[model samples]
Target chain A: MTQPDKGPVRPRHNVKIVRKNNRMEIPSSLDYLPKVDQFVESKLKKLRIKKDQLVDIAISVSEIVTNAVMHGNKNDLGKKVKINVEASPSQVEVIVEDEGTGFDPSSVECRLDPESLLKEAGRGILIVDSLMDKVEILCGPGKGTKVKIVKLLR
Target chain B: MKLSSRDVGDVMVLEPKGKIMGGPDATVLHDKLHEFIDQDKKKVVIDLAKVDWMNSTGLGILISGLTTLRNNGGELKLANVTDKIQSLLTITKLITVFEAHDSVDDAVASFSK
Candidate 1:
């Protein structure tokens, strides 16, 4: 929403429909992570988010989106991933939703300790949490995972 | 990710360009790092100034290199860490783990110390 008075809060489902405004729809593919960063960075710049802050938010969003595609959706082309961004006066919220079984964040062992440092996986979620102001993960037996990441605007 | 390696004196400097995302890119760095280890070249310096950015996957690669070298009685160090990557290390508390230098020459010099 270009209007300053009327906020830009909208739901985007289809990939085609996301092209309407500030929203971007990404496929359930990890290969698209960089593209997602490019889109988010440009939009954040338009919102006057600083370069450092932009990188932090973009990196956080990428981690969440990558997890949704690789872990939740399992990179299934049949499944879909929707990313919606809503910037209010106070903060900016980006939601990454996937049509797959959800994961428990607590179950993940980040292994930041000395022994686990050499390992490859498990740092995605931890880094996201540290970078974002707020990270909310919602999932159920039948319901897919929805990750809401919010960054305070400065 | 693209990798370029050259020998500076006895040390090996591997310059990886582009984002070190997961998938084939991860394997490339892993294999190259190990390749040097296999050759008994334990002293290594990874120049990160040219790199655009790296996710956890990139950090993992660095960890893998560090440990592998330590096991071989060699060591791995980082040079020219960009602001973006430095922040990632700081947030993850990895800034405490890796020794970073302002330039490649500095990192290479640290190996002697």
Candidate 2:
């Protein structure tokens, strides 16, 4: 059987990305969001995930990664965000970790509230939770944040 | 994301193709909307037909545009919202916030009504 197409091979920028199989590490900056999406999606595509499920997983990854870059790592270029993917025939799991002090996840405001509906930020985690089949947020002060999201392929 | 805009009568229709996940890509869409806002272009429609998907960042941008436009006595609408984006809007309850139409023409015409 021919190997699956991995999409385009774009030229790497100045951002140092360490890629090994289904794992990738990058600097903590929003500039790498697209790159992160590309890396994760290319891997998921190989699994023959349905279009809708693929988009759902892609969106969730984007949300978690954005949080890892902005809130988790404080967008400090010195810090780094790591993304690892594990896929089986029926599901895919993505883990995004950042090197920074973590905050209380319960403190996250509910964007669904009428008062918070207009807020610009703060919806990343909410969206991820809505899309993913399983979401595990491991965080603590000075321990960094690790968001693992799992999506079932149907 | 690649962004382009055009004017239909008094309404500005902005077309953004590709994912609108956060970062500089999101900034481009945010800036373009504000540019029109600063120009006093009150009516706007974002065509989302080409967008494969977007996360919270995209939603934030839409909310920002909607609130800023309304605050300035303008209005922002959505045209051709894809199924994925529609699901997002529904999940986030933003579906109730903005007026979305089936097509760009419908959105532009609604601005007059």
For this target, which candidate reaches the highest TM-score against the unseen true structure? 2
Residue A64 lDDT (model 2): 86
Q: What DockQ, between 0 and 1, does each candidate earn?
A: 0.21, 0.40
lDDT of 2 by residue, B1-113 (tens): 87778888788888888888877778888888999899999899999999888888989999999999999999999999998889888888888898999999999988777
Model 1 chain A: which ten-residue window has the lowest total lDDT? A1-10
The top-ranked prediction according to DockQ is 2
Docking class of 1: incorrect
Model 1, position B112, has a per-residue lDDT of 79
Q: Which stretches of candidate 2 lie over 4 Å from their true place?
A: A1-13
| Model 2: pairs clashing at backbone N, Cα or C within 3 Å | none
lDDT of 1: 0.78
Candidate maximizing lDDT: 2
